[model samples]
Target chain A: MSAQSEFDREIALDAADGEPGTYRGQLGEGWRIGGGINGGLLLALAGHALRRELGETSADGIPGHSDPMAISAYYLTPGVPGAVTVRTDTVRRGRAVSTGQASLVQEDETGREVERVRVLATYGDLAAVDGDATTTATPPQLPDPEACVSAAQAPPQFLKHATLLERLDLRLDPATTGWAVGKPSGNGVIRGWFRMADGREPDPLLLLLAVDALPPVAFELGLPGWTPTLELTAHVRCRPAPGWLRVNLTSRTLSGGYLEEDAEVWDSEGRLVALSRQLARATSPRR
Target chain B: MSAQSEFDREIALDAADGEPGTYRGQLGEGWRIGGGINGGLLLALAGHALRRELGETSADGIPGHSDPMAISAYYLTPGVPGAVTVRTDTVRRGRAVSTGQASLVQEDETGREVERVRVLATYGDLAAVDGDATTTATPPQLPDPEACVSAAQAPPQFLKHATLLERLDLRLDPATTGWAVGKPSGNGVIRGWFRMADGREPDPLLLLLAVDALPPVAFELGLPGWTPTLELTAHVRCRPAPGWLRVNLTSRTLSGGYLEEDAEVWDSEGRLVALSRQLARATSPRR
Candidate 1:
């Protein structure tokens, strides 16, 4: 078995100091839209950095509470492609859960340190928890990967330059991919399959990307252009098993040119891995 | 008009210094579950403090971004009843949006400072925005407040001591409030009407409480007991009009003893005023 894959290499960050929570890394080229890197990718990087810092060092003699229960990030500024620093502070540590904050920073054009993203997350050891377990929510019925349309094919002109989209094997359920061709379903729902292009084992961090991988569901409402996310919060219920993650994204309200997206990520095991909601602005397609 | 109503008196916090961002206050008696105070009320306090700090004073020549766009809080510790300090720090100041962090702190039994809650929020100026305005989501149908059952009456024994519940007049939609009588609707949806008991105007802060005011929808799914939330994030779409806020709360999944709740608050004007999603654990009732 290979020790490391390109997917891991692209997302990995090295600790800047002997200190455990301070790390520095740069996003790969072409892994961006306009001047900013993908929000999901940035979230994943921050989640990974946080997991490395808090989870691995739990004093309970247990390996880690690598299970990400909840995480939210605010896109404070545009994260340009360059060396970025991630600093995490473990805020509180308890028996069953831990809380921390991670900030993603980088220097801007004038060489001033610009904070790009601020993320707060919580981790929990499910084994330590006691409660009733049940799920009434079912995964959306979707076409098998082999039968779906790959987002990589027939890309919209605006997204043609987003090579990062190619790294994730994203296939849209044919019925929901109509917006790509200018014909929207108008139902404001999108279903698809998301898996790492390199086929790495699925983990909590990967689930973060899967939830945000899809374009805003509002695009189907005939609203054009890039929808920039203002804030995103994701909840991870449990560790996911390996296999393609099924994504169901829905927009409940599109008001004042602002929309809120709700998403669910279900693993092949039929287990709900993560739930996410984001607030974003629907900027019309450039005239 | 009275300078302070009982509802406002309970939720209000005094600024600690001439400094606009710092505050000192205490959660009112009977406003807790177990030893911790209510998360919704904590969020409301932070939002009020933030709005007071950012909105009341804007050098932009325009008013402050009193319109809260998004806010997320991580419960780090059980916020016990005590004199607590809330410190706010402005993270970023922009023309249209401002981001900040608020920390709710208290001294523990050992006299050590414990950070009970950490919140990050973003504010916007709706007046500064332009574009298509519309709301595709509609409020759920419900009986008039007079026809509905007040959550105030027939209180669940577990919440009998909660005085906070009395401050907020929450009436349930008859169709979904069956859980109170031990009937599981098995639908996992709860509809209700929420307004300040003292008849205060329905503002963004009060909407925060309204979103979380309902008992966990899972309770109606045969999942018994307190469902303690681990993290909650709310998006205030626009300033709400004066009147009772209509609330719709739904849970898409309850898996691995965890659940995610999505809530929408519509003002009497039928406009979407706030959107929220929460991640929580479903701890069953004691045997």
Candidate 2:
């Protein structure tokens, strides 16, 4: 089998029980980021768990919805590779919108279960709603995807250990990737085309990971380092078409060691799929 | 007492319990918008409750933080005037940051409890951490406060019943308030100076409401009406100095009857007090 299938199989979860709403999954070695798993992957895992729980028969007399309209996740502890469990609670099941909360936990060395992530999501049927206005906002103008430099072509020696990079194909816009050449733009913006490494179709859950998968926008502001998210909230406006996603991220200010990152994702068909905002630590890079 | 003083008294919450973390408050007559209490005031009420809970001695061994780092609120239902209770749960108490969740619930007609609002907040000491960088973002440029038209001098007939307006004083930037005169610039931006109507000092809690106090940005797009928030997330960066706050709100896309509003609040000293983004319904106004 190919590496893409292997990565997908490792991330796929299995339902353990339907009554109390539980799922069992594991973070394979491919999802590792440094000593722990990626935060966006964990969020997607919880979102997938919630999707399964809500996909069931009507809970609280409200039918299950398919698209996630809003999702907020809080990271309490770094996730480890091992047996993991996800428990979901259906907060309210309304006709137009439904809300749910999920907790991702794993066993510690003492055999005690510890919570690693907590997320709340709201899902609704986007097609059912009538359109009030058409979008005048166009996708970010960029060079042809085929003409751009793919992150998969030549892995930098510094990022050799970043196994997560192997799961996604990122075509960085040559104009915005100046940081790769050590010439920071100082214009807090990053734009690029992104898609699954395995040529898999993009979905709402995949969009979640794609939003944060890019290098921190702070890198362009002369700050080179990992900026961990304190909290991230995303709003899904429409379902994505089957193709590459155009993403643009920017920050207006970086003050007091904290900065807010705003991101927008547009599908290949020129449709806005999701918008997200995250408050993260802007740690000074140690060179 | 002036109407401003009366409005403040109505929204002020009282600590109902010294332990277990509970607050009792009421939404009075002046706080109404249409038929329900204003959502911004509700957020402020919850923020106040969280501030009070965190201000007490360390709970669960976590040190008491001084300012709100991030807050997210989901409006489950329209709030009604009566006795409302806010119960807080300390999720985790760390040395630098603490996490907590609060549920704003009220008793229904049958005496059964119903949750009207849910919020999660993170609190930390802004002064404890050393500054790594400075912001290049300047506060929204507007005319002096004394030269602008105050929302208090005259109440428009459409907003005559909106008593919540009496509690907060708004000096509209002449360039952005053209919607009041049946003309719009179609720029999708609003800038103004805001403070409590009763001359009350703007605290972290007040900053929460101030972020959403202005008219929805959708009005500029020729869609005039009530645009309610589905979800709003805010990050408080610094302890706001006592003075007027300069605010600017903008929207990038309005599609499929939904739009996201982004706002920034800067204190008179040019310090960014808060940054917020909200997903709200873009409903058309009835002609």
Candidate 3:
């Protein structure tokens, strides 16, 4: 099987085909070196496809936005080589919390199963922050999008050793903010306007994964050999009518080869949508 | 209104005492000032106290030993000084996870409540590790007890701080070896051997709070100035037999004025019995 482009290939939701308690996924061989399909990516894709049956628009339809996700993914297996298929099923859904199981599968020319995973999720209404019934958008003010080149404008770095995030394409409204660097294939803590990079009107879930691609704004403070995220727990703040979203990202605390990053994502209305904290393991690129 | 040395104070275990439906704590003022607590203390207080309730013996039950527990304490509140009373309630007791809620409270002279802390804990089964079921007592192969001066031997930075710890009379076995630094009353991460500075053994419950006296190993790698913690979730691998347990500790990561330190506590038999992880706001002594 070959996957040359997103439009050129087609697959249905794995839940329709597989039963509960079972999973399948591809362990991409060339997916990682510096960049590849890591935990965040897999989680996004699986969560996205699983939404239709849940009576909610994909995490994208939740309104306002940049990655205002209150979810996290735990990496149990590395992305290996090959085309991957993700299967998901509802594990439990309550008024405030719900869980889903996802499995990644890979097959050789003969269609053999490779790697798989099952995830449990818990989500809540972000509308209750600081006693506010609906999430309020009073975030610290940031410069306009046209005034700077956001990390969104940078070409995403897709590592050959791992799964590359080829699905994202970003743009900076200002296209030339001074402090922003690496407009092309931006690397080492992205600074920019962000989006699906595919020109799709912003979706919260898509934004969630996109933000994960960039380093936290705090990282721009200049910490080196940065590696972050063994786990991530995000708090969703506000939701607004969607439009261009801009954010500044930086990295810090490059010590012990392990680090954590915090992000503040806002909406077009300047409302705070979500905040994420990620921890990652530092790995030197194999020369 | 004044708190004298009311050491013999005891409070009945009222199962239904405390405000329900409220989820938060008043972190002690001192633990937030960069350095506070060690894992060995946490283990003794937590593990020993729990064991004692389950019909275990005192510190005198163990003979030759050296178990240094370098652990993590994610600070939720500053300390609650004065005739402190703690209440520990078991939440869940599964084979894989044993959960408990411990609250330390202090009442003002007028009997007004001043501080309260709730710690949710997980004590993993020792069988989870590749070790024997019953704890062994093989002393660590190190110098004789006459060779090294225990951390308790070091001059107390605050002569007054020593008074509180000195009353406990915690003596250490020589085989315990590790590196640690001291923390001022209001600055920096501290580490080193930790036991009751007083030669007398203490009730295991009171002993756990002493770990808050050492510097969190995480602050070593935090940002210049900041300490933030909304919650603390800790896991202890096994239970150390009560006695003078020694722990080798180090400050691990400090970034964004926030730090995280993961520690391990091992007994004289080279068996790992406890571990902890703490998240702190990364802050400099003075900006």
Candidate 4:
């Protein structure tokens, strides 16, 4: 058998023997952003649980409601690398789509279980979706992967405490990396190409993580502290083609200590695969 | 006491005497578009319930976590104008923010209660939010409300079955209202000025309703059938100044029988007050 990809192994969930909608998993290391695990990774964990609970064939002989069409997650606390529990609840089951909710919980130092993230998702069969395909948004222009600067090779200051960068091959658009050297573009935009280091093909589930893999857009605006996501919503439009995924993240408005970052993920086939928007706390640059 | 505005009377909720976290409210008339209630109004119902549940003073003496910062809702079934029961669950209460979930339920013709919408929201005090304010987005430009075409006086065909227009003073940009006639601009953009007919001021909760008030962006794309929103997420940034709020809605892509519409609501002071994104079914233009 082929070796399992790091992402697959990290997000793998074991269903509880007696619990119909409960699963257990582990928060693997090497995915921490500052003092906690990445928000996207945490969301992917909940998404996986929701998929497992809602992907079953309906009693009415209906099938193919496996892919997550829309998912939203609210981050309550930062996740740490440890054993975690995910409890799923089927909100509604219909012929075409089913909705489910999942909560990721972890045991704190005091032995109390604390909720890390709560997610709500709707599942449907992407293959059954057929109709008009129109787009006014195009893939962001960027140099080829080889020409872009590898995030792994970014300045030491930029790579500090971001172990998650080691697990993915992220190539940032050179133009937007000015913040690494104390020269921010002040444009509040970040574009990059993302793929698993092991070259695992992208799927609807993984797109949840891909949408938030890039650095916070506030970096380009000269604000460099860790921006914690408060809430994030992702819409998986279609299955992505195999290859590098182009990502563009932009922050349009920052008010009241919060910023809304919108991301668009495009596949190598130039198809728009997923779109996401997140609300996060905006922090000022460190002195 | 001053007379209650129609909006205030319509959205008023009565606490369930025995249920700690339950409230009942009517869906109200004149808010129907097609055969179902507007998604925004349904969301507002749920938001009101969450506010009542989470707006209490914390035991830790933390004050001002009342306004909803981010809220997401999944539309499970079409909401008809009737009595709705909202049940809220407090997910977590923190010093700075509190998260809660609410589900709107109503009885169907069969006498079985049906869940219409499920919402998850994070609440915080908008008044206490202070820090660096930065924005790359500016309010969309549009002709004065007097120069624009009032939706109430729109073409008869365009005003058909839309009683909600009579409650809100909506003036659409003349350039983008071509869709009302058979000449769509084909730009998938809608800009307008929005205000309650009774001169009610926009609040964090009302902004939820205002964000989804405009016509579907698909209409400008020459596809004019009813677009049912599958999921929607709105972030209320701050309180608005009393005046006609400018709203701009845009659709960037339509694929797999779905499209994402993003809306930005700017107050009279030109400060962005709320932002929303929704995924909806895209329908073909009726021949």
B-chain TM-score, every candidate? 0.91, 0.89, 0.51, 0.95
The CAPRI-style docking tier of model 4 reads medium
In candidate 3, clashing pairs total 92
Task: Order candidates by TM-score, high to low.
Answer: 4, 1, 2, 3
Candidate 2 lDDT over residue span B223-284, tens digit each: 67777777888898876778898999988778777888889998878877789998887776
Pairs that clash in candidate 2: none
Candidate 4: true interface contacts recovered: 0.79
- Estimate TM-scores for all models: 0.93, 0.92, 0.42, 0.96
TM-score of 4: 0.96
Worst 10 residues of 3 chain B by lDDT: B63-72
**Candidate with better DockQ, 3 vs 4:** 4
lDDT of 2: 0.77
State the lDDT of candidate 4 residue by residue for B109-178, as single tens digits: 9999999999999999898544235887889999999999888876676566677888899999999988
Which scores higher on TM-score, 1 or 2?
A: 1
Number of the top-ranking candidate, with lDDT as the measure: 4
Expressed as tens digits, the lDDT of each residue in B68-149 for candidate 1 is 7899989877777778888888788777688888898889889999888899999887653332345568777889999998
Please compute DockQ, using alpha carbons, for every candidate against the native two-chain complex.
0.54, 0.52, 0.03, 0.66
Ranking of predictions according to lDDT: 4, 1, 2, 3
Q: Chain B TM-score in candidate 1, rounded to 2 decimals?
A: 0.91
Q: Choose 1 or 3, whichever is better by DockQ.
A: 1
* Residue B242, model 3: Cα distance from true site in angstroms: 16
Best by TM-score: 4
Query: Can you tell me which runs of candidate 2 are displaced by over 4 Å?
Result: A1-11, A57-61, A128-133, A152-158, A284-287, B1-19, B56-61, B128-133, B152-157, B284-287
